[model samples]
Target: MENTSTRSTSRPSATRVFVARLVGTGVFDPLGDAVGKVHDVVVLLAHRGQPRAVGLVIEVAGRRRVFLPLSRVTAINPGQVITTGLVNIRRFEQRAVETLVFSELLDRVVTMRDGSGQVSVRDVAIEKDRNRDWKVTRLFVQRASSGPLGLRRGETFIVRPDDVTGLAGSLGPQSAAALLATMEDLKPADLAGVLADLPLARQVEVAAELEDARLADVVEELSDDEAVALISALDAARAADVLDAMQPDDAADLVAELPTAKADVLLDLMQPDEAEDVRRLLTYDGYTAGGLMTTEPIILPPEATVATFLAQARKAETAPALAAVAFVCRPPLETPAGRFLGMVHLQRALRERPQQPLGSILDKDLDVVLPDDSIGTVTRLLATYNLTALPVQDEAGRLLGAVSVDDVLDHLMPDDWREADDAVTDEMIERSANA
Candidate 1:
């Protein structure tokens, strides 16, 4: 729900309070009997804008941390939190959709933009809305220096949500839709990071703002579970659009993870031609050549000249690996490919003869892979040919698609690759950034 309450431009210096400021404060029951110390702040991740504080984690007798839902709370102040007569003594287990301010965000590393410096989060300020729900508004960051045999703390400064680049920083209550407009320039990986760092509801809101192509790019970089979660958050039509925009093989891989009924619905919503490609890929074992190959390759007729191939290659400059080869076939490209002639490697074209006939320079002794070839077999064939791309064919000799090196590595790399976008070498990021 949108918070329509009047709010300050930022957390007022006079009344700004932090999660750290509340911990250790005595919690009093409605009858005024002291019960325990405020152990932590529990926030609901499903808020409309920024997540709101829903309750306090109190350390009662026996060192048990119990849930005290905000709905049961009576009063909250800096020194102590006074609860209503009702309190659930059951131990609290953090839910997938909840966040513990102290455990998750505080002391985390964040880059502050105004100074272009990275600092550690020292504390965070939370404020109340008209409905009395508490929402996080600002981050307090500080650097630490080593003192003589001791840890010396640096001065902490406030960085409102507005100040952090690509983050939903806010000075006050902001419309989720408004926050999305500011995210246009962010890369999918950057967008994913921002989404991951935001609350669940805000993640869905930001996702809703992205175009299908943009969201597909982001989804490709997310883990399966995370991708499924995000896709599920979207409306059915939008989710289907996003799946359609992704590489067919990748789309099928993800679709296979979804419950069958849901997967079928998405496939049904997709364009018939696109859905057919995914359906074909779904039939291949995930570790086979067909499983990893993308259905959208640059295909050219056998009579097409090298210049024609060059034009197609130029269109794929952003993804150089995709230009590995131009599949050549007879007219009316379709099942059985009308006679699989061969391919023209982008690098094999001599600069002196840009107009050379592509058919005349067909990749000689071509090593084609069958649909069910094992990844190891595909890898060996690719290595033996010194190829950056290899063609996958059906038994009938149709040029199905080409498998780029990146597609192969995507499956072999460590599971955490998508989570470490910033881990790229500066040169790689710089080239991609400028390109």
Candidate 2:
């Protein structure tokens, strides 16, 4: 492969070569003394709103890896990196703001428009931006390396970063707002991760472009801070619409995380029923049953048939998670849920005739809790019985809503779990009726 740039800054030429060629190239001082061999290049993301090379890791002796700051670098080409010989002897530690191209980026699948079509990164091409700062401008994509085909026509084109999209459904930086109009059926948390990876400007653009309902789903997967940041970017009406689209429990959590004035405005903008649901949940302690339980679950009347249960389960497929059990309750479906009949495990509905009523199929040994029940009690109830969901009742034994295990996990896991690299996927959601 050909490459460009030269030892003299004023001298320019057309040269092109893969970045990997620089991996083991020898580094030298201005006097031509050998400083070391190139180990890796360090890039600071969003440096000037684009990833830019900031430093390099060079091996001085057999064991010592020294940092060669970018300011000391004079030239970079296909197989060689020239430095001013000055180096920091300290060992390299990747800062949160920095990433090693050869380590964090290589081989990761990047996509366009969410996860629609993807390209595997063989190498990233760094070029001098208009400011003369080294910025990652293109990717050497391995088009069809995984398939039986060796390499196709479009297999090795070098395209700018914006041309690529998601990494396992993540949104890459510089993705067009139009491409994001279609979010491709992705898990909310996965979509959130992609959103988190985008630059703030593009993220806001996508925010304005996304449907309120879809935005709500993706927002539910983000941290309260990130969710608030994105929501604040939209018009007040759109923000309220997004909050309304989210489940009442998750909506309440996101709202609670916002400023009082912002939350109040959103609540005021929401429909009375939806606003009231979130307000009620907000009043409860986040770690308590009232907080852990969703205001909406599969609630049914005793007279509701098995067919009705199946239909509800099917509708819940569109939701982030489904209630594993259906609570048979009286009218008002609210906190003082009127009279509570027992619950019917959704699994039992499959065994019985669709035409049959649910009353006869209720679990005889039901363990229920009040909204004020401690989180420990709720966790024990869910774990001990291997129950996928537990009913939350009020003082009157009225069924309010069900406490799903996913909610329990949400309350119990680390604060940053939604952004965790191995985020909990929609397996919990997919098993809408799983026990």
Candidate 3:
């Protein structure tokens, strides 16, 4: 390896290393004894300038991880890293400001400085400065083929960081087929944990490949900050589509975190009915029943048969809590219905004849809460009734929406429930990649 930076007389030429190839390479001590293996390269991204490589995340014995600061690095060899014998065994925790080069930078999309178009980052080359510090200076990128059939491959080349436009900003589109394949067996909640472990750039890449419905489920499982960041990274059209796919209350919650102008833009781009539902949910304080209720709960007219309610409740799209009962209303069956009548539990429906009118056996005595009611009131009512969901009504006795137990739990749980790091393991990713 050779140094790409300017030569200096004060120190021997520094080594230029490609981060992707550096991972898994052995780290050796002065006496050439193996110490550990490199797992990732850490870099500090400044507001304006090339990112400086600060250190390496290495895996020692017992599957313990540790940080190896660049200052302790001595030399870069063909397939091994030379470091000072002194090593700290503390576990590595990625700070908010630090980025892992291989997991974050590789496969990122950036625009060429010459206006050639967008390119995907294949690898990044880092070299030591005159002071023996490492900094990312070269990007190995590939432009998408413009051929008639895309039969020809894109051109691949290396350029300085200044030669690209979007490397320092929010993430852009990239191919995520491989990464998605690695997650093929994961459920949405488990998949969300794996994604949370990834950097924002990788999250955006995977988001671009996921179907809107699946993406919506995964986003709902993320923390507020993580959800907002991932949603904001997608293009406007797709972002609105994803919002439309999400439940009204969840969509409203995410939009509430975005800037006012951006939120308005996305809501306008969404389907009219979907946007209206989310808009109504956003009007109430987050701690009120109105904010936690979903506008799409299963609703039926008084004349609807028990059979009809059963089919509606069985739809795969209906949320589990909301599907536990069917809300029977007057003339209009949609939300803000003509008049709130009663609810029919699925258990009761199963015990009655299919031809029986839902209203005939409905639980008119079911407890209800006003939209303006506090979350505490809603929680007490649900617990008091042992109900999975409770109806919200207006002063005129019109049904507005239904608040499910999941909605209350989402607010009551710790804010970082979805960020548990152990949800996905390094061994899982390695096996998936190899498979």
lDDT values for all models: 0.70, 0.70, 0.82
> Over the stretch 48-151, how does candidate 2's per-residue lDDT look in tens digits?
35567777777665335567886788887555678776788776666777766654465556764323356666676666655656767666665543334343
Model 1, range 1-435, lDDT digits (tens) per residue?
001132434337443467777767898887889888776688764424575777777767645568788677667776878887677878677787776765455545555555545555566777776767677677766644433434345645676654544332222222344344445677776567546545555567667667788788888777777888888777888888998889787798889888899999999998888889999889889889989988877777877888888888887222567776888887656533555788788778645287788889897588668988988888788778888888788777778877878778777655555533344433454564375
- Badly placed stretches (over 4 Å) of model 2 are 1-175, 178-185, 316-321, 333-336, 418-435
The ten-residue window of minimal lDDT in model 2 covers: 1-10
Per-model TM values vs. the true structure: 0.58, 0.60, 0.63
Colliding pairs, model 3: none
- Highest TM-score against the true fold, candidate: 3
- The C-alpha local distance difference test score for the whole of candidate 3 amounts to 0.82
- What's the CA RMSD for each of the models? 16.5, 13.3, 11.0
The residue pairs found clashing in candidate 2 are: 2-16, 2-17, 3-15, 3-16, 111-165, 111-166, 170-194, 171-194
